[model samples]
Each structure stands twice: as structure tokens, then as C-alpha cells.
Target: MSAYMVGYARVSTNQQDLTAQRNQLNTLGVPEERIYTDHGLTGTNRDRPGLNQALAAVRDGDTLVITKLDRLARSLPDARDIIEELTKKNVKLSIGGSIHDPSDPVGRLLFNVLAMVAEFESDLIRARTREGMQVAKAKGRLRGKQPKLSKNQEAHVVSLYRGGQHTTAEIAELFGVARSTVYRIVQRTPTLN
Candidate 1:
């Protein structure tokens, strides 16, 4: 029997365009029945139903087509892991931007180099974000997460707690805050304690 080919496409949000990705595979003559699409889900999620369906449907020695490696995954590690799984299954991965296969020695060398470069880029992004946050804090721009309760509500919650007028759960419910916040208040403030 001939090797079966299936395609997977994804869009970050429901509003994003998946048509281009789908069309790329369609241009390669992939049938509608063999194409799976996932819309409005984060690329970071592993439990993607459409991706799972495509993986499940492909048999040994089958080909899995994606318009781009990034269309299949967000993170480089995620892409590498998915490709590794496919390789172990005797499945062929065809990336539009790639004219090589990592299973071969030369291709393996190139793939590792590219993968390491992508990982380096991601690390730089993380470092830049941390530095940006530190600079923001120095400039007093990093205010942290805003308190769910306003000053008036916090004072009211404290007053009620001090007077023993309400339980922790009740205070949480009344202020629409968390029980942990109530506990933190009662433990930190001498009047509430």
C-alpha cells in the first residue's frame, strides 16, 4: 500500500486565518478528509484534539505534512519533541521551509544546528523580558498585579474581620477576593490578628 499523508493546521485564535496553511497542504494534493484543523487553542497545549486525531490516524511509514514547523508547534522543544515522536513512529515530516530530513546524517547535523539557534533566540527573549521588568520596576512602572479589592473594600473587610462579624469564607465572598487574601490580611495586620 502507498504511504498515507495527513496534514495538520492551527491558528492561535478563532479569528486568525488558517486558510493559508490549509491551502498550502491542499496545493500538495492532500485531501480534505486527511486534513485536521485546530482553531482558537494555544500552541503550547499538548492535548490538542485535532493534532491528536492526525497523529492517531497516521500509520507506520506514513507522511505528516505541515506548512511550517511553527504551524505544528510554538516552542522549539515542542517542535523537536513532536518531530522525534514522528521519527520514532517511522513517520515522515515534511516542512515547507525545509528541503531536508533529520533522519539522514547531514540533515541531522543541520537540524541540530537550527534547533540550537532557535533555542538560543528563545533564551535571549526571556533574558530581555527579565531585564525589561527590572528596568520597569526601577522606574516604578512595574506596579505588580492590581489588588482585586479597592482600598475601601479592604478596610471594610478588615473592619468586619476584626469585629468577628464574618468568617473567612464570608469575607472572601463579600469582597469577591480569595480566601488566601483574607488569611494573609488576618495574619499580617495586628488589628485583624
Candidate 2:
């Protein structure tokens, strides 16, 4: 049987457009029906429903196509794992138009080298980010996200919960915060020793 080309497109956030990737896949003659997508999902997350569906739909003599290497995987290990599965199924992985067949010696080497380079790049980025965060911390600038509720509001939330006057949901509704926020306030409150 001739190999069918299957395409996958992903975006990390809902605000990001998938149009560009879709256009590329369409240009490559991947039928609209065969293109799968994961919207507002991170590449590192393997639990993506769309990715699972695409992988499940591929047959032995099929080719899986992605617009970019990063779109398919976030880390080297993940890339290797996916490739290994495809190898077992005799499926070809196409990244940016470069086809890599796990059954081929040269393709295996090339794919490994590419995966290593991508891993190295990701590691460098993480290192740089850590260095930046450290510098910011030293400068008293890395305070992270601000608390959604004020101190008085949190105290009120605690009091309401302790008084058994309202449920966490009720407190959250009254305070205009999430039930999780109310739980945090309760957890952080000091207990009498």
C-alpha cells in the first residue's frame, strides 16, 4: 500500500493562530481531513488528545508530517520515544519536509543528531533563563505572580471558613476569588502551637 501523509499541527496557547501550520500542511497536499491539531497545549505534554488521535489513525505504511521539529516534540527523549514507536509501526516521520525512516541506518543517525542538537538548544535556553532569574532575584525583582487577593481579603476568607459560616465556594464567591484561592488562605494561616 502507498504511504499516506498525515499531518499534525500544535499551538502552545489558544491565542496563537494555527493558520500558518495548516497552510503549510495544505500546501504539502495533506488533505484537510487528515490534518490533526492540538490547540492551547504545550509540546512537552504527551497527554494531548489531538496528538493521540493522530498517532492512533496512522497505518503501517503512513508518513507523519509536522511543520517544525518543535511542533512534534519539545525534548529529545520525547522525540526518540515517538520515533521508536513509529519505527515499530513502520511509519515515516517528516519534519520540515525531511523524511526520516527508523528502518534506515542513515536516517537513524541523522534523526539522532538532529534530536541531540534540539536538546542542546533547549538546555541552553533553560540555562540562560535560570541565569536571568538568578540575576533578577539578586536585584529583588523576581517576586513572581502577585497574589490575587489582598491581605485583609485573605484574612476575611480564613475567618469565614473557620467560623463555619460559609463554604469555600461561598467564601470564594463573596470574595470574588476562586475556591482554590480560599483554600490557599486557609492553608497558609498559622495554627496555634
Best by TM-score: 2
CA lDDT of each candidate?
0.77, 0.87
lDDT of 1 by residue, 1-193 (tens): 7888889998879889888988888887678889998999866677799999988888777878888655667676776787677767777776663444546767656655665665566567779999999999999999998877776777777788888978989989888889999887667666623
- What tens-digit string does per-residue lDDT give for candidate 2 at 1-193? 7789999999999999999999998887788899999999987788888888889878898989898877878788888898888898899888878788988999988888887777777788889999999999999999999999889978878888998978888999998888888888899998555
lDDT of 2 at 171: 90
Name the lDDT value of residue 23 in candidate 2. 94
